[model samples]
Target chain A: MALGGDARVGEVVESSSTGFVSQSYRLYGAPHLGALVRTGGPCPAYGVVHEVATRGIDPSRRPTARGEGEASEEDVYRSNPQLEHLLRTDFRAVIVGHASEGGTLYHLPPSPPPIYAFVHVCVADELSAFSASTDCLRLLAGSGIAALEEVVAAFLRHAVAAQPDPQAFLAGAGRQLAALIPGDFRTVESILLRAAP
Target chain B: MTYRESSGRYLGVVVGGSMTRGVDVRLSPDCPVEEMALGQHVVIQGQSRRFYGVITDIALEWSDDSIRANPPDTSNPLIAGVVATSAAYAMLRVLPMLAIEGEFAMLDGPAPARTVPPHFAPVRLASEEDVQVVFGAEDSRHFWVGNPLDMETRVCLDLEEFVTRSNGVFGKSGTGKSFLTRILLAGILQKSAAVNLVFDMESEYGWMGTSEGTGMVKGIKQLFPSRVGVFSLDEDHSRRRGVSPDYLLRVGYNQIEPGDIDLLRENLGLSEVAADAAYSLARHYGQERWVRSFLDVSGPEMRELAADLNVNERALSTLHNRLSRFRRYDFMTERESDESVEEILRYLDRGIHVVLEFGRHRHDLSAYMLVANLLTRRIHERYVRRKEEAMGDASREPRPLVITIEEAHRFLSREVASQTTFGNIAREMRKYNVTLLVVDQRPSGIDEEVMSQLGTKLVCLLDNERDVDAVTAGTYGARELRSVLSRLDSKQQSLVFGHSVPIPVVLRVRDYGTAESYRELGFLEASEMRRQMERDADDLFGGRD
Candidate 1:
């Protein structure tokens, strides 16, 4: 059951135990990067928005620049209404934890979410409960994505804003990151610098 | 983080180590490492018992080499906090001293720690209650000498146990040796059943002693006037000091035995042949009159006298020159004086302590050795006889005597220990009810047997390696205690161990030279002092007042 104003951002197009990929219904309508988004099912899997993209629905077709003489970017899309149906917004979420019978568990879910599962952007209250403990940072840091540093920093910046005590949470997250990434102070320092409240 | 109070606060956990090497403790990060001090008493909670120990060493350690190569920025509180707890930590080496089973089992007191606490045993600072259970409370038999390092609890010495065997007071010069000796003597006088016969070589222990802070403080005699009898050898010097000593002493040349000469070999510069000839001369003229007879011969007849005595002429010449030194001492006379040994014996028989003052002869080692040896030999003989008689009738036993001698190395050195009566008293160890309180700076010069036999030793700062070794020799945990003993502050602090204390402890010696110290030891004002004298007399010889 989605709460008031909980955006129904996407539907799961691909799924696995570690993560899942979702496609938004409307073109260019995916949640912003690093946002906490959840899959809807009997057992919902939660993740951080690690990667997002917009591409043509057909594999052989490539989307090209069509706004050279347009007054604004909106005119190009409005002139060709068919572009909305031809393009798709999809995102890959790194699974940080899942909702269980007891509460949010900062660990991998036992099974993947069903394909085409509805994915919604999590509310501030729901995000606070998941980020209560920094244990989930280990999962995010070990995801092995090229943009891991930026993803962690951006996710912490969003999570810390929803926390009751932002400074304490930032410091706690900093120590958690410092310990999770062994001997890699440059990465930890860079993440801490950007995530600092 | 919460601040932990040090009074019995949980310090750390015993990590690893053995009995001989002592145990190592890894301090918790929350407990500040700076608060850990050397020689601080700590208690370890073991499986079924508790062990007591002292902190011997402290260290900083880490798990990863990368942390050291590229140190983390600890300027951030969170970074510093996490690093201190996870990667780096403080460690301590604690030498366990005593152990006890169950909390109330202290009635038998703590026994020497034979085994170490199991790994990961919780350790904490010894609370006041724990300290009290270890060091008994001060009472009539237990004298409060001072407080243990950095603690308010009293460290008491069982004076009765102290006097049962010979004890020693040792330190380098100006390390408060005299003041420490004075405190022990005052305690013996006030509390113990033993009577003291102090060979006051420095003349400081008789009427007064000077402290660096206090101008002049009262001595044992001044505190226990009626119970103490000050005997000076120089009547003129005694009068000048306004002492009016109870007895004035003068030893006759006949009292100088060959054994006394053997102890003064270095002081008199006597050759072996010369020193041995004194004995043969005694055999020729009899021991009672040999010294006077040998010194009376004219220079021209010296060779003929040597021929008649069957001694080398040159050795006889050396003997005569050395014997002449007795004549120059105003306290030595042509005829024996009753005021010397007889009066000292009378004072001892009545349970009055005798302080034999050297007066102007303090620096004269020859004079000090001669008089001390001569009187102590006679006293030892009387005690041996009285002790034999007491076997039949216990009432006839003389009061136990504690003979205090300063510069004791000169008397009890390995070369001359057998020839001196002081050494015999040290070895005999209350066999005839007499023991020694040897006071010296160079304990290394003293015989090993004598140092090993001293029942209790109060040692001050002695930076000399051998002296420190000699003082702590043959005791449990001597090796581990070396660092604590060496690092003591130069004054007022002392390391005490042996029979009197249950465990070895470093303490700040209680005040000795202040007027307040005198009052604390029961010294009285002038009017009350007179009444106290009368009261002591009444207690000793039955009331006459």
Candidate 2:
């Protein structure tokens, strides 16, 4: 029972105890890094997008490089008709927590989303509520996620922009991060300074 | 951004990872961290409890690591110059003040705990009320010494703890050690909790002394006229200061004791045999008349006396020669005074501070050591008797006494510390209501045992490693405090720590010569009232003229 505003963008392709990989519906609309994505049947499992990539689906097929002399941006895509079936986008999301009827719980989900389950972008409300606590940032920072600092910074900026008052939300997130890593002020300041408008 | 309402002055936020004993704090961009100083108290508001800490270290961390890692992009001079002054974060190392319970307790008051603050807690500057709770309130038992650096609140020391145990005021020369000692003496007098007998070595404590740059520094006697009495060994020097002596500080020939001779052994260059000869002559002629008769003896008379006493002849002659030099000091009277040791004790018992001015004999170590030791020995005996008599009587309180000795290392040094009465008082005087305020330039020269017994140490700048070690030895937080002590300004700054203060603190010592300082110490009121009374008396008596 996905919300009407939520759009399915991918399906689970691989799974692990810590995270899972999903293939996008097309070579476009790949979930942004640090964006929250959910996939499950009745009970929803949540994760933060750690990596997004697009490449030829076949291992032996290497796409020819295009120069900047293209007549128009869309002309290249229209000219390569085989790209639609040959290339695909995939994203990796580290499983952060799960949500039941009770509420959203912060921790490693009981299990990774099952294979082929549809993955939908978490709505703004859910993202805002989850970002209120710095537990997610702590999870991503401590996890074996790729580009950890960059991922955490992106997630903070996205959450701040999604809120009703971006400025207030950014300040709140700064304080939350400060409380999360009080001993590492250097990291906290780095993240907040990047998050600043 | 909407700033959250805070209960305290939000100085910064804890930003770094937790340390074993402390945490790192990133000062808020809006915070005036420039005004913050080391040792300033701060509190961090944790989730469940508050954490207290002091600013131990501060640094600036640049945000751009790429600028240093990669070569400068000199292709665009403007871009290179712009990146050079990029963002720098102010980072502080805060050593948390925890209670002994090992819980993250609030630092709003004076409770002790041993827990670190929760992450990202707002670090706030400690308020005046918090400082009062930590340092303690001003009362008869506590006297305000000076304010902490960069704080408006006053810092005080416990007067009772200060006078009950031996203490040291140590610094290199010209570091305002004398000024601080005078302030402490005034504090002790204000409480009237003890009797102080100051051995004024340079004649600084009894009368106004002149500083090369600052004119006419007031002495303790001038500050508290009713409570202080000045006694001088040189009457002409006292008259120059417009002060008449209370008793003229005369020591009768009988007052010379064997301990006094032993204390002066180094100064007189007497061999062990010569020192023993003086003791033998005392036993033969009796202690009272020995010095008088020995001074009158000729060479043949000394040899005859030496034979009768079974002493070495040459040693006896040397002892006679050394002991006769005292006759040149006018304070050493051949005849006894009607005013005995009991009279001085009586004045002390009534709570009057006594300053024994050395006057012209200030540089004569022999006279200073001999007189200080002899007078203190008699005073120590009297105190012991009084303490024993008042042992079980709840209603009787023995008058606590403080004996201040300058060049204290001379009397309490390694060689003579065990033999001097000052050393005994330094060790055992707390029980007898007597303590020593040992002042010295070379604290390293003082004996280890006596230095250990010092309850409170107010240290100014000391560059010598041994001297610094001597002052900070056996105290809590000595390791951390050593660095703070080393950075003290060469002028009027001191780090006062020990039983009197809860934690070590660095303070700019209070101004001594200002009128406000005098009024705060009650000196102005006491002196002004005395002058008014004198003017009235003059008007009443001179109208007939």
Candidate 3:
């Protein structure tokens, strides 16, 4: 219902029960990949930014290289203000869990974030409560999402800093992953290596 | 990281298990698996009850087989911590033996665990209270025998149940079998109404004996001198050891019989036919004078005697040669009466334990076999007749007797077990209120039937495969106990199970030989005994000179 000024990051451009797409107000302003983010609704849905992309808003027109004639990439963007309007940055966050009445529930929410709802990057305390159990990895483990291991690894890497004991958090996530991942431990171990501080 | 904590000894949770096959406990990630040793007790808190279990085995486990094929790189501290906690972990194989419910547990004692705890039930290292609940506390009727391995709580034996049936103490040589036997003997004397008749082959049960670590340890007699008496086969040797026995045991010529020679068949190196010939010799010379009359026959006299009995002369000569070795035992006499057996019986009649020391004849196998068999046969005969008489009148019931014998395999071997008195005592159990405490190093040499008849057995480390099999055969939970028995430390540790203890336990047999231990064993020092005497006199008479 309410949020901090710095917490507001973007508006929900696309919505689905499993995931949502958010377009940043400023170019390249989308939260870091795997950072946990929330959306506005009666029952707000939490998500992990699994994929990020910067491309032309209109699918028909593809932008050619304008950097070759400029002194630097910044000079091209300054020379053509239309370039900023034409291109956009969008992040696809898989709905890992949702906020509940008593506390955060590390499971899928009843409804997806509303279309055009404001997307807010979660603060440290929110990240702490969500990462405590690391139970959301169950969704990413078999979500049929691409680069699933990398997404889980990246989530652990960013979430550990919010934990009281970052090392213990990483280890807790590994164990949670051990129970969540249905395959060999090597898969879980490889992911852990990527998240090691 | 605080996955679970129950009184801070929490080790794991019951992941999976069965009533018959025990349970698999997934250890908490923070718990060090190496610290969980075999034979240590664990208590599991169930939904409505608690289960007590012993750690029979431990294993390294993974969520998958990849841990074995492609182990995690533990090079980094974070990776190492994660791998240790999650990727690769430990599992404890616990055998839940006893179950206790809330108020019922305090009243009825723990019952056998009939079922495994539910999934994810917390398992903690058994506290002193849990161990005490299962084993019971030391009191007037129970004796503190030892501590459970690595635990301070005393493991007590119900002396009432202990002396009710035949029991055994077994271990390889130098495993403290004799020392443990001394402890049990002292317990029986102090706690129970049963009287002991120990055939002290090494003279270790009377006065004082030498120990591997502590020289000159006090014997059962020294611990309870008023209740215990030493009867020596070699009077001079006993005197040299500073033990003036109550009686000097001298086996008369008339006391020796055919069956006594039969028990010594292996030790005397006599053939079956040669040993059997003694029966005919006894029938000829009369049972009273067979050993002496047979030994007295000369070169031609022996042959002529053998022919007269229709026996092979060479076989008779072999018997004579082996039988003549008994002459070197100066304890042998030509007296007309059986003095030693009567003396032992008289002492036992007075409710006093008699440890018949072999003295110098301790190393002589023939002497030990001859004296132990001869004495037990006469004593058992008297007990059977008295028991029969007592059957007609319960008031005439005699005090229960526990006959302790070392090198029991010789007398209870498969060949001679049917005939020897010791085997009969073991098999007959407590029918005549006469049981046995068989102490031996090689249990495999004993008759299988007698071993099965044993009610309680305390076994130390036995590396011999056949020996282990012999002790554990036909036992409940033998497969699981085999693991516990295999892991016992070589000395001062024993696996005690059966009639006396509620559940099987591995005990770190309490310290002995120290002055402090003597006090713990209820031994009053000379000054203390004097003060006790004064206190008793004060209670009896006035507090005056």
Candidate 4:
């Protein structure tokens, strides 16, 4: 199937066996945490945004004090024309699987995203199809990343929104989590409550 | 549309944890967890097989982190409402029933092989067919006793097993123990599986009695007039209720055995020496005529007789004084009545149920014990003879007989159980086609051996620990069933578990006084038969006018 809504958001700046780093076009509309993004061709590799960071592209660049005037937030942005290009946003996504012609395969891809590979936001269909199974939630829960539960909850919310029946998807995910951690019902309930619409 | 389809009150999903045989179930939002009672049966449907289980325990888990992250705004009703549903989780611990592979092949036949249903199977309220498969279908051998709590299906008991072994009905006052016993007896009669002889100490089983909510509760004789006969120890008292006894229960002085006197020793307040002296009197005057001839002896004659027998004079005097109480009872006659023990046995052999109503003698412990013991002893001996004869010819099968004795603890207590015929019947009567349906409020007072011999126990609400322990003794799932028994409602609820029921179940005894229940129990047909008999009598006598 031809990819639709393929908005180029970043480029693979760093690569690893498990994950990769991607640099966004600018700070505006940087991918949200847990947003499914893919890179590579023919058989594309998929990853979930785990962390996001923003900084000035030039380390020496610094803001100078300006006198307070009747300038609103919009005027400040317009006056500093270089501010948009000066700063850059970068995000880290843990590579989860790769897409095949038959279907979306869920596992570590054969090869990680190459350096400078263009990262594009996955459309609703692709994201929904990738999240049909909850294996990624298990991976995120055990990832030891900062705010692991919060990240899972965010991914669940995005997945539910991408589905046709949000309530059914949320309930299914709740059941999946319940089965996974049958002893720890509190954690499952917490995730469900956070993910509830 | 989703790939999966689920239906039926979405009870929960099976969950796995540290439990091995038990499964934790996470209830769904639509499931009414509050209404789910313990001991209620549920089914978990798997791909290939269905697992049956009972709800043993329930738990409520609160997600602390979820609550901490989104603290309820109690000031706002909407947010508090949202928090209530979102934060709390309910879990049910289910002990699954063992499913043998070849022993139970779905609906085909008994299959064997221990298999647990797959995990994460959807749990649902057990269907009627499912319940019938587990509890046998209502047929000639299996009869409906009551409905399990929260299910439309009828809970049936195996009448064949029930008649082959002794059983017990235990409850505190007003918990419907009598009603449950009545239902069971009615079931037995409907099946014609056994001839029940009820020693009605309260006269409650022979005549109608009033309950609190239900108006008039018809007794066994009233419900089955054609099949049940009421014999009263005090016919005068029963006559007040317009009930004419089929025959007066007159026990001849010659019929009282030494064991009968021994059983009455406590009620007679006889000292050990006095009881021993009575035996010597029996040896001298013969067991049949001793009590009669002893009553006739004068004070000086008794002193002389005691001296000659080498017995205590004062002890002999006390025994004489206690034995005089029988003179007031017209039914205790020196001459044997035409309605002999053979006649009662004949009726039982003919598939007739007999209720020996005590009437005014209901609270007369001595009278009740003497007559119950003497009559049951004769019947048991006759049964043993018939059983021996039947052994020679299989076609001559001895008819199954069940004698229900109220205040059973008095006869089966540790002090006199060895000597009482009721205890013997509870222990060994099954082999002779005779069983005792023991009813009592204090089961703990009964000997443990007798309690263990009971095949099925219908336990009503009992607050006393010892009574509960006694009723639940030898029950397979006593640990889990104890709580179910103890928590029963004090009126019409009971827990029945034993050889008859596959698993322990709590049931509300069917409405006894309702017309529908009466018709269901065949009382309407009995009443119709009575009316027909009355019309025939009128036609024969009124023609003289």
- Highest TM-score model number: 3
TM-score for each predicted model, relative to the true structure = 0.84, 0.70, 0.95, 0.82
**Local distance difference test, each candidate:** 0.85, 0.77, 0.85, 0.78
Per-model i-RMS? 3.2, 9.7, 1.8, 6.4
Over all chains combined, what TM-score does candidate 4 have? 0.82
Candidate 2 lDDT over residue span B1-545, tens digit each:
22122345787788765544368888876665577676667777777555656677777765545444553444543223222223345788787764322231223334544666767878888777556666777898888888877777888898988898999999989887888898899899987758899999898887786542466788888888878888888999889878888867788888897778887888899998898777887888888888898888996677788789988888888888899889888888886753656767877877888999988998899999988998898888887887788886745655788999988898998888998889999998488889999889999999999999888899988888999998888865465566777778888888887767776778778878777777788776656788887888989887435
Q: Is candidate 1 or candidate 3 better by TM-score?
A: 3
Model 4: pairs clashing at backbone N, Cα or C within 3 Å: B101-B112, B101-B113, B102-B111, B102-B112, B103-B110, B103-B111, B103-B112, B104-B110, B104-B111
Q: Per-residue lDDT for B239 in model 4?
A: 95
TM-score: which is higher, 2 or 3?
A: 3
Task: Note the residue pairs that clash in candidate 1.
Answer: none
Interface quality of candidate 1 as DockQ: 0.25
What is the TM-score ranking, best to worst?
Answer: 3, 1, 4, 2
Can you write out model 4's per-residue Cα lDDT over A15-115, one digit (the tens) per residue?
Answer: 98678899998776679997888887767788788899887787796655443662787676678777788778899887777887877776777787798
lDDT (0-100) at residue B81 of candidate 4? Answer: 38
**TM-score, predicted candidate 1 vs. hidden true structure:** 0.84
Worst 10 residues of 3 chain B by lDDT: B1-10
* Candidate 1, superposed: residue stretches over 4 Å from native: A1-197, B1-7, B66-86, B305-315, B337-339, B392-395, B527-545
Instruction: Using TM-score as the measure, name the better of candidate 3 and candidate 4.
Output: 3
Error of 4 at B101 (Å): 4.3
lDDT of 1 at B64: 55
**Candidate 2 local lDDT, residue B419:** 83
What are the runs in model 3 whose C-alpha is more than 4 Å off?
B1-8
